[model samples]
Target chain A: MQFVRAIVRPEKKDEVLENLSSGGFNAATVVDVVGRGKQKGIRMGDIYYDEIPKTLILVAIEDADTDKIVDIILRTAKTGTDGNFGDGKIFISPVEEAYTISKGTKGL
Target chain B: MKEIMAIVRMKRTGATKRALIEAGVAGFTAFKVTGRGKLLDHSEINVPCKEKLMGMAASDVIDRKESEEQVVTFLDDKRMFPRRMFTILAYDEDVPRIIEAIIKANRTERGAGDGKIFVTPVNNAVRVRTGESGDAAIW
Candidate 1:
């Protein structure tokens, strides 16, 4: 199974969750996150802030389902049209094994 | 416009999840994450990718799949799609201790694993049910 770690604009969470759920990947959890991008923190008028907040959406799916889920997330999350700074990032990685506590069995 | 999140590398979080809940992290999410960090901080991975090139270029791979373009598409079409993967989320103040607990739990099995923690800020938030604010939603 592949795992997705998405950092998106916090405001986009609703749309993201909606798309993910409507797309048949309903099981998800959202967390409040903070960090900065290559912009090395943002600078508005004159404030020098180092940390930035982001919403992290975490989910796991079968290999066959990776593409669809990614599409849904990107469509709903990617904000800047010209690749602006800190538009958020998505990380996909492999999961070695999974276990369901309620079922007490390994997930395939 | 601020969020508090932490990436804590832990050994297989069998019960650590439940522990997080008990610690007052009402609704939390977790994913099977892998890191080159302290090997002691490991989790059970279900699907393993033999060949992997992560970070910046990974995004480019998504945009370049179709059409006649040597440079590839700007936005990769397959980054967050299938809505499948490993991940978990929790509240702010709940992080430090929870991750600490996670690290402690991992340490029980492995010793002094190398790992780094990161925290980032969020711009806005919406609570699906009643449409609450970030602070009100979690705090």
Candidate 2:
């Protein structure tokens, strides 16, 4: 199993979630977090927003489905054709184990 | 690549950030978390004496019998303290320096609850905009 964590712009959250659901990956955990990327942050006329709000979507899927799910997020989360600075990034990691709480069953 | 997760006292977050930045870390994510360590401070359990509750002075309560003591009960004994968790993704070579920086910023003479540091292997990282992966993506 692979654990995919995507941090995307807040506005694109629903679109990304919808796309993921339609892609047959419905189970996910979403959290509202504030952080900066390589650009550090953005600066306006007289204000500097050091902590930009973003949405984190977490999903656990079969290793073979990694590329498919990543593609779904990359496509739906991008702002424009070429993408923007805050388009967000996706991270893939190995999942050692998973368990179903109610049923006490293991594996996802 | 490695992911360094440092949990430190909330008040030391700024110091930790500065330390990480000075150590040449590109970027990191931080969030507020509440957790408890293995060692619990008994003094915080809040077991008030009956004499104090009855309006008796401290000196008078010292001579009081143990039966007069009142122990407050609660649903749970554990207390969670607020902390700041910093998640930093960096190259393998940079892990040691980053960990040192985080420890220096948060460590104090006081023992325990100083927080902890966890290092985990990252399978891969992707830069969404450029479609870059591996070391090329992280920097």
Candidate 3:
């Protein structure tokens, strides 16, 4: 299994989650996070919004499902057809092992 | 650089924090989260959520269904436990030390729910205040 971590604009979080659930991958952990990237931060006419709010969505799925899930996130998280900076990013890492606490079993 | 995320018991958070700081790693982020380990016995409970947030325009809140996304659900199972996810961004050399500190502080003889720790490569990180990137940003 691989863990998929997506840092997305706060507004797009729900859409991403909805897509994931409808696509049959329901288990995911969502956290409220703040970060800035290459653009550094955004500037309005008068003030700068330095720490932009983002939602970090964590999901562990079968290795085979990686592409599909990533696709769903990318499709749903982007701000528009052209995409924009701070649209957020997705990271995938191998999960050595996973266990279920209640059943006391390993590998899921 | 590598990021170490340890999800341990909420009560052990203080000890874990102390251990990390004592290990010479001062900055870290912690969040309160609810999850179930190997048990796989929990059920999801859907809680009602409104389609549009107070400050958002009705058109801005995409109408996917019932006006709100089903993403805002809660776990209804008693078996699901609450855990704290402690995240640390450090240089490559400090990864092992930080992980060790977490295990030493959170692992108890009582067993099982000591929580899980995972290390992942961070392609890059930036210090928002300084506009520094990579190792310079974290160091």
Candidate 4:
């Protein structure tokens, strides 16, 4: 299994979930976070916003589902043609194990 | 580095955070989210209305028992399981210990909503200020 964390714009969160749900991959955990990327932060005239509000959607899927899930996210998270900075980033990692607390089942 | 993501009950965030801190984890992120799992619930108010509208509209007093039975399956998909999720990045060796701390702090009962922890291997991490990457970045 792979754990995918997508840090995306707050406004794009709902749309991302909708697409994921429609894709028959509805199991996901979301969290609201604040951070900046290579761009450092956003500046508005005389104001500087160091921490931008972004939604981090966390999902665990089988290795086979990686490409499909990433495709869904990129398609729904891009800012326009060619994309834009702060469109968000998706991080993939190796999941050691997963458990269902209710049933006490492990391994995926 | 490995990322330890723990989704626990909202009420347990404080205890969980403290546990991680005591476990020598320096940095992490926490957020509020609603999810759906194996827990059974009867919180959906729309299910009854939809059923009544679909069933005999002439019955002004909808059958409570029948409505609940018909909608449990449908409502399962729509249920929201409120959770507080925490993400912690630590050295590979610290992963197990960190997870143990979280489990110790979060395991209030062995039922649904108790929570879950996912450990993922992080390929790389970068600390923007110092331009440090990999293990240094995580520390």
**Candidate 2 chain A lowest-lDDT run of ten:** A97-106
Residue B124 in candidate 1, Cα distance off native in Å = 35
Docking class of 3: incorrect
Residue-level lDDT tens digits of model 3 in B72-134: 322222233678888788888887677767777876755655677766678899999999898
Error of 1 at B25 (Å): 22
Q: All candidates' lDDT scores?
A: 0.53, 0.71, 0.72, 0.78
Candidate 1: where are CA atoms >4 Å away? A80-83, B1-139
Residue-wise C-alpha lDDT for candidate 4, range B1-139, written one tens digit per residue? 7777778888888898799889998688887897654324444544554565457534565676675555555455544567987888888788777877777777754354577778767789989999989889987
Candidate 2, number of clashes: 0
Number of the top-ranking candidate, with DockQ as the measure: 4
Cα lDDT tens digits for candidate 2, A1-108:
777989999899878877777787755556678999888799898888889999887677789999999999999999879999999999987754443322223455
DockQ by candidate, in order: 0.04, 0.03, 0.13, 0.37
Instruction: Pick the TM-score winner.
Output: 4
* TM-score, chain B, each candidate: 0.46, 0.73, 0.70, 0.71
Better of 2 and 4 by DockQ: 4
Chain B in candidate 1 has what TM-score? Answer: 0.46
- Of 3 and 4, the candidate ahead on TM-score is 4
Residue pairs whose backbone atoms clash in candidate 3: A99-B38, A100-B37, A100-B38, A100-B39, A101-B37, A101-B38, A101-B39, A102-B39, A103-B39
lDDT for position B19 in model 2: 92
Q: On a 0 to 100 scale, what is the lDDT of residue A99 in model 3? A: 46
